[model samples]
Target: MIIVGEEWEELAAALSQADAPQRVYVVGATNSGKTTLCRYLADETATHTRTAYVDCDTGQSRIGPPTTEGMVVHSRPPDPPGRAYLRFVGSTSPGGHFLQTLTGAKRLVEKAAELSAGATIIDSPGLVFGGVGVEFQFQMIDLLRPTQIVALQHGRELERLLANFARHPEVAVRRIPVSPAAVARTVTERRRYREERFTAYFADGLSQEIPLRGLGLQGRVPDLKDPHGVERRLVSFNDPENFALALGIVEEIHPRRRALTVFAPPFDPAAVASVRFGSLYLDLDADPGSMESSRP
Candidate 1:
């Protein structure tokens, strides 16, 4: 889906003059072979012009670590001149669930607006459930402004996205069907592997790829003591509530006998909290001297 920004009309006029390569944005769920399709397209068109695949799937991103936390061009200089991959790693900030994740996509649009080169292929993030994921797609379209968008379908998600895309005139959305034969082969292989590798007791309610320890069941199964009830608690620790308890057990069994110098540095709690949470964003356009206090 495309949403041309301020200079889109001018850019379209410019593309009409020269041999501007068609920019394509392929969007789909995880493991839907978006990358595979991009690579195939690139290879097919490689002999004539240039091709590049911008991987924007963060968290489980496959493209070698991103150039910048936001968005940056990534391609070796000797390989091709006018072509490069625009890899965008969403946000790394803790609990950054909303617009923060679309930071990379924002940068991508800005860069795409500036380019006058060959085809720019963008592989976007999966529309994972709720509103945040759905809105992120709109943000991407606003950024990349791809002439064409290919959405791979697995369920009703693709239809929903298409309905949203129709509301905007700038984008031309299309649907392509994945081969059922290929999907059937994958399922068969997985079932075969699971039957041979794991025992019946452990394989239930789990994928064949899931490891025994990775289940978080420890050794024995958990009991449903409060199946109907619910409880909530918070601690300084991250995931898995029994982290502190496990650390206490470790200390008792094999304690490290070393004195530590823990000097608490003097810092304003309000300032520290602001910095930690990044509540105040630095204004890049502002005078450097005026913004010095906000920097490290």
Candidate 2:
């Protein structure tokens, strides 16, 4: 069960006030109660306005699987963890793919707004430790321009970010204590979580081939000079409008035939317009090895 102190009630009442927020951005360090608080607010906020929750944490996501920033629009409170409109970030980490992380978030937030959502709650990743994390979040706050920022802090650890927002009076900031129930996961557990999601996502995955003549390729191009590492890397297939359709694992790349074989979900081949590859490679069917070594 998720439990919080007086800070939780205060934030809830503030949000449920007469003028409901159009956008709320939740920020916190690792193992903080960011996701739990978001879940509660997504339900409570829906009492006042049509609600939408944007899952931006690629490592531990509730709206969609990992490696994607997803949106869930709801008329009432969200339940059973509904289906999400997702945009693949190509990688799980934000430092390497800062553009992808923020771009996907900006696009999905706009998409949710287009659906007539009155309130969009964004749940962010727990990466507020170093210089890269600080800069990345600073840019995200600038991009989202949220009506309020509900920051969960273990103590004074997130004081820098809160102080940064204090300089901008337009952005209201609410600081709260993290719930004791929030669990801190180890690195191995994180990888295992991704593996479980990948297995479930590709449960019925089939190996298919798409001719590379017209479909534009993106992300790291397998190092054309090396070409040694190609198999098992995740690739995102997007439509003409840049909406992600499905994720596939590279099986083989045929330079001669200008095509690539991939084991992925059964999406309409004709709809495939662009391909984006992820930096990390995976062998989901095999044993768990060091994921860092798998990246080239």
The regions of model 2 sitting more than 4 angstroms off are 18-21, 77-83, 223-227, 289-293
lDDT of 1: 0.39
- Model 2: which residue pairs collide? none
Instruction: Compose the digit string of candidate 2's lDDT tens values, residues 77-126.
Output: 34443346888887777868889898888998898888877788899888
- Expressed as tens digits, the lDDT of each residue in 1-296 for candidate 1 is 22223332333333334365666678776556665665545444444444445556543343322111222232333454343222222122212434534554555544544553355667676564466656667666666677777776666676655676676666667666543322322534533332332122122321111112222322111122421211110001112321111000001111133111111122222221100011112222234323212122
Cα deviation of 99, candidate 1, in Å = 3.1
| Residue 75 displacement (Å), model 1 | 9.5
**What residue runs in model 1 are displaced by over 4 Å at the alpha carbon?**
1-19, 66-97, 112-115, 181-296
- Residue 105, model 1: Cα distance from true site in angstroms: 2.5
Clashes of 1: 1
The per-residue C-alpha lDDT of model 2 at residue 271 equals 88
Q: List per-prediction Cα lDDT, in the order shown.
A: 0.39, 0.79
